[model samples]
Target: MPVIAVLVLDGVPGHQLTAPGLAFGTAARHHPPVAYDVRICTAPGFEATGGLASFRVETPWGLDGLADLDDTDTVLLPGHERFRDPPPPDVVAALRAAAARGCRIGAVGTGTFTLAATGLLDGRRAATSRRNTAELARLHPRIDVDPEGSVVADGPFHSAAGVLGGIDLCLDLITLDHGMAVAIETERQLFLQLHDPTTPATTCAAYTPPGSSLAPTTTWMEANLRHPLTLDDIAAHAGLGARHLTRRFHAETGLTPLQYLLRARIQRAQWLLERTEDPVERIAALTGLGTPANLRRHFQRQTGTTPTTYRTAFRTFVTNLTPRE
Candidate 1:
């Protein structure tokens, strides 16, 4: 069991307070007793957002609760009203001590400000709410602030952009703790619970929507995943130089054209593996990976399992869905 301490100040962000419990709880229940020790530890300072402000907040834990954490544990900081101000000396020391004990530190939205003040984020890439990105950069010059990403994880520290991004971070942590299958189910359950039945659930792909300059190019890549694509080919299709294409593609999708193409190919392979009776060799060629060995290598690298294993798990998942639910 992994222990997670959600350290909330007065104005705790709703996402920080809820997402961990939701994501981890779903994992715990769906996986048959992978107990998670999640607790809300209250401390002084901060203001509440959303409907939480209307009521008095109370929790049995405090900052002292973080003392028991080890490397496998996580300490989460939620954005509060006073997050913009520097963290108090005791708070900073406590965070530092937790880090020294190998506990991972995570922050959501403005909570990153408190993490940054502790100097733990120095020389690390971090992310925060888009609206506050520039200020985060200016205040913590040593921290490399990424405005484009919804979440950034460097070493043992992780930071997310907003409420939704915080949930994504938690899902990522679940994946790290268990595996991709558990994480995907957790994500699917969350989507099912949060969205209307009429809405379709989306996959966890590095998918980019339209409106970017690279939209047409991405669409073309998806349609032509069977072809072995090169940088020059993608650049020509986009009517740009290779250098310009890489820069623009990365700006829009946070991935190079080739990287995006490979992921798209793998995603296609996943769909084929789940829905069709295609052999590994056939699926490999269909996805432009050329050989079964090649497909297995990249598939394992991205998904943490072989193609056969993934298909087996998917089958088991479908079979067990009714009883588990």
Candidate 2:
């Protein structure tokens, strides 16, 4: 059984990820030869979108899982609300490596834009949501955008229109892997399972962060990344004791509060480096890194390169994607 690694980022839509997995699972049940070990892999330093109704997913795998993958396996990127932002360097690098290794890459809705950021779909005909087709074409002119294609397949790159088209894309992938009969059977099983009354509603309590959850607290931290915050300040915001907050925060995010804050600041710096022409000094101040030296030190330690170097490479990549006069 090959692994179907579904890469989800911040603000990942609930349905986009679930549909493909359910479809593949149903297909595998019908045809054992096409079994897939589906894994929901979260991006490094994954954070929630901080909506009142937003829930968290505890992903068993991270980007490190992609470092060693079977070429026969597939990597599917579901639509994330943050798709407009340039993907983190680690994500871009992982996808680039997977593409080079001959992995089948698929994207849905805004996910198409994220894949395009990798430049893998630059010259390929891809489809996204009907509304975003023109914006995608405007951003990545090298791509052959399909304004009306609900599900477009160009070489190894398969794309879907939106959340609704996700199942179609997965069935198409099943069709590519097996025969049409298996795909048809998979769809049938899926529909039956959906309408099955015996299938009980799964409790989301495990996924829901507790009332004391550090989710809202983390959102607060991100909002005040430029401010000078302390452990006591964070604990106060969360209404937990300092030591209690540390333990809870680490348990949830795998990082201590201060550690998470520093990393968040570094990610903020990365965002500024890629999206804006801000100098290191201003970025450092804005991210609460204090000074250029402090920013360079932490940035280099975390990113393995300097801030200016990262920005220059990003600009060069974007420039190459642009059509010149």
Candidate 3:
């Protein structure tokens, strides 16, 4: 069983605390036995409160309760407002010790601010709410704060943007460590959509058309995922040289044009795999990925499952659903 310690702070978002709890909390139900033990730890004088209704929560343990931080495999820091100020000396020491012992550390929203203050995020890829990006960057210039993605996982540390992104981060962890079936079931139990990290619009405003020469080229590739087009063709269609297109493409999307095109095609394949009854080879063809074997490789690489396994699980999920038919 994976033991998860969710470090709670006053004013922590209730949903952020509950998201990972619900996902990992239900692990036992997944394999017919519980696979995780989750605990909420707080500092002394800890009085947790949240919700529009505003309720107070009581915990039995204090920071000393996390004396076992060294033994914990994963530590979760949920969204909290007070993370701007460095954590108390004792808390910082505990966090530093946990990392030195090689525990996977995770932070959600401004909770990242707390983790950053521990000096553990230096040279690490991390993320926080857009509202706090400037502050995080200004405060910890050594930490790479990714403003675009909801979550950034650099080796042993993972950080997320906000409350909802917290859920996505947990799901990603479950999917990575356990399996996609566990992740999907957890999402179903929590009444949250199964998130795809590449679908940026769900958690972020769509990046506007930057009016670069690569703009129309990307737009065309997004629409033409079913067809194979060479990079030279894309450059010509965009009315730019290949070198110029590559430069502008990377600037606007933070991905080389080829990389962006591959991501778009893979996302399309995931959509079809989840929503349609198409055969794997057919889905591959439609997504411009060419072969079922190739599609399976990429699907597992991106989402931790093969096409057949995903479809089988999806079929089981549909069977369990109440039929509108």
Candidate 4:
């Protein structure tokens, strides 16, 4: 089993600590076992303060538990109320040691500040809550802050933009560990939905007319990304005319029906490429791209890289995290 160490600190928000356990633990409950051994560790005398008024938390493991970096595959840092303050030296040291030992590091919300403090994020792309993006950029100009991305990954470091973005990041890690199928199953079991990070927000008052929502149709499309879908087919599914579907889809999702379908297919292809050892041709067939050449052309157009190159980089990162037996 892969070991995931969640490094806790004083003032850590309650949800941030619990989100990882819920995500990874739920995956472990799935058939065939996407197993992870997750533990919470903190410095001696450390206590976590919840964002709510009535809660405080204590973990069983201390800083000593983190000393053996070889036993850890990933370290997740959760944001605290005082994220602007420098992290404890002992905590910073352990994080650096874990990175040096080839463990992937992830930060949630203002926790990006904690990871940023270690200097490991220098020259790397990262994301944090939109409210704190300016401060993060000002404090660490060497680190590239992606204000628009919900999740940003640079080499071994990953950062998420908001409180809920942590759940997305964890699900993404689960996808990396097992496969898209496993992650999808886990999402269903957890009653969670995974949103495409690149999709523009549809909730803006200007875009969403009162009482009008494309959610039902979009949800259907997400569940059926493997099919070769056409505009008419989508229109019928949504109980609208083709022209009406195009207008509503563009207005709601900021993408035309075909554009949305293309992005959905590419997203599916990316998931398969990152998590499965399937060949490009097989992935193409699975994602409804028809053939390897078609998948390559579309993938390069969207991502500016070949599917093979993306797979190699993702697999290399995964391999480096797995300790030799």
lDDT of each: 0.77, 0.77, 0.71, 0.74
Q: Which structure among the candidates has the greatest TM-score?
A: 1
Kindly list the per-residue Cα lDDT of model 1 for residues 1-325, writing each as its tens digit.
7899988777665655777888788878766535689998776553344443444556677788888889889998877767787777878888999999999999988889999999999999998877889999999999999987477889999988765537778887877776554566576566443243332232335455334677678888878878888999999999999999999888877789888888888878877877799999999999999999999988988766688977766655445432210
In terms of lDDT, model 2 sits at 0.77
Candidate 3 lDDT over residue span 1-325, tens digit each: 5667888877787777777777677545544433777778885445765546555676665665566655447888886657787687877887888788888889988889989999999988899876788789999999988976477899899987764538778877876765554465555444423464322111111121324455556667877988887888788888888899888877776677777777777767755766788899899999888998888777777656677666566556545542221
Cα lDDT of model 4 by residue, 116-199, tens digit:
999999999999887889899999999999986478889889888755537778988877776554565565445412253322
User: What 10-residue stretch in candidate 2 is worst by lDDT?
Assistant: 199-208
User: Model 3 off-target regions past 4 Å?
Assistant: 70-72, 163-165, 192-325
C-alpha root-mean-square deviation, each candidate? 15.2, 20.9, 15.1, 17.0
Cα displacement (angstroms), candidate 3, residue 322, comes to: 24
Clashing pairs in 4: none
When summed lDDT is taken over every stretch of 10 residues in candidate 3, the lowest stretch is: 199-208
Candidate 2 local lDDT, 32-148, one digit each (tens): 556788888889757753235667887668997777776898899888887899999999999999888888899988899999999999878998877899999999999999998
